[model samples]
Target: MEHRYLGNSGLKISEITYGNWLTHGSQVENDTASKCVHAALDAGISTFDTADVYANTVAEQVLGDALKGQRRESLEIFTKVYFPTGPKGHNDTGLSRKHMMESIDGSLRRLGTDYVDLYQAHRYDYETPLEETMQAFADIVRAGKALYIGVSEWNADQLRAAHHLAKDLGIQLVSNQPQYNMLWRVIEERVVPTSKELGISQIVWSPIAQGALTGKYKPGQPVPAGSRATDEDGGGAESIRSRYLHDDKLTAVANLEPIAAELGITMAQLAIAWVLANDNVATALVGASRPEQIASNAEAAGVTLDTGVLSRIDDVLGDLPETDPNKTQSPATRLT
Candidate 1:
């Protein structure tokens, strides 16, 4: 896989990162997850992204086991904090010092690692002081618990404040993880510019818009049997509906089939390549339940879309993509 420096940091990560969000513990069996992880490694993917809250912390354990026996230095493992992993308690959530300190230890124990390459704040903590949160992150770095720090789904202002604080604290905040895809351009308006000015690159998720851009969900057909849209218990179907499951969006996506055919790639690869076309995007994160999915996505690592194909994509998906800066919102209360 192709690799790129994460923002201005010296650390280099794969252009296609394998992420285990809904699949590791909740959607697939452990053996299946291991196969997928092996497939990623076989495809030369060196970066893996997970979160402590994924599947109530079981995802980390599964990923840890799957990654066993590889040279740790050859891989970059990233995990996040800020979501409640245990019972509801005053100190169980948020980016408070107590929670941040305790969460790192728990994540290390579960991941079977002494230190993570990157530790990210899963969301902006509205309840905690930014100073307290950043100070805790600085401490984590000083204690050698994590090497670099990042944030996910943070607004431009929130990212600027944290970036400034990280600089003052002598910490390297190098990346911001956001939902960026052909169908979702919310990060393009303000977040991308602010991040560029701050020397931060983006590790984007859901590049296929939860499989909608793959043209698997037809415009007026029943939801595909094994697709994410049909898996109500997985808790991702609703977001897919609100984002790209409508007839208008599906029809737009279907119009891209000829384009993908002309390019001699799958619609998924076309979508992933589109995301990677942005210079500020360091990596495009993909999650999979099966090994073949990773293989297909890894093909998009070094692929480039021509100007005409990109224009065709924009023409087909015109005005359907969400690009408003105000859409980058954090929850008023900490998510449990």
Candidate 2:
């Protein structure tokens, strides 16, 4: 497998990272999570990404139990904080120092780790002062509770502010996590350029666009059993993720099939390979329910897309509307 330096952090990571977003927590059994994690490790993927709020709190435990007996130093653990893990309250979540401090502890306990290789603020908290959030993260770094600090879903301005804050305070903010894929290029307009300029690497989530790029769902096919698209629950469960099923750009997926067929690869491989193809991407956080899925996802790490194929891909879907038609907006040409 190929490896890349995580931004300018001096940390080298596998291009593919196993993630437990929809598969762990309560969506799949512990045994399944274990199989996925080990399969990823065996396939040479060395990083895992999880968030505090995934599965309402069980994702981390599932990961921790899965990693048992594995060489801790051989793998990297990344977890995010900021989303509410409990009922809404002023102190229940966000990047406030109070919440940041407690959230790290809770995450460590659940992951069964003493230190996270990277601890991220899920996003900018408009209600909390940036200074408080930076200072809290600095403390976490100083205390050796976290090896590095980062943020997710943060805007370009927020990223600039955090970079300077960390520089002045002598702390390192290593990477930014964002949702980036052929199906979603919003980050490319601003976030990707900023991260590239700031020397911060981007670890992309939903790198597969929640399986939309997998090409398993035909436009009118019934949602598959045990698939996230059919779920009814909304608390970070597979059901909760079905909202993406309504995504506007999924029509774009159909355009790539002929190309995927030409490459003798599944749409899934083509989509994942597209992410890895970008030099700006550091690691792709992949999700899965079975061991084979992890293995399949990892193989994409080596699929190279030449210039012509990339150009064809761009010509097909690069002009998708900004607001995600499945979510809120219309085609770009009609937008005022």
Best prediction by lDDT: 1
Q: Which residue pairs does candidate 2 place in steric collision?
A: 231-239, 247-326, 248-326
**Residue 227 displacement (Å), model 1:** 1.6
lDDT of 1 by residue, 1-336 (tens): 899999889999999999999899999999999999999999999999999999888999999999999999999999999888888577788899999999999999999999999999999999999999999999999999999999999999999999999999999999999998998899888999999999999999999998999999998899888889877886598899888889998999999999999989999999999999999999999999899999999999899898888898999989988888888878889976
lDDT of 2 by residue, 18-105 (tens): 9887779777889878988989988999999998888867899899999988888988999998877866466777788998898899
- Which residue pairs overlap in candidate 1's backbone? none
Worst 10 residues of 1 by lDDT: 226-235
TM-score of each: 0.98, 0.90
Residue 89, model 1: Cα distance from true site in angstroms: 2.3
- In candidate 1, position 319 carries an lDDT of 93
After superposition, the stretches of candidate 2 with alpha carbons farther than 4 Å from their true spots are: 86-89, 235-251, 321-336
Regions more than 4 Å wrong, model 1: none
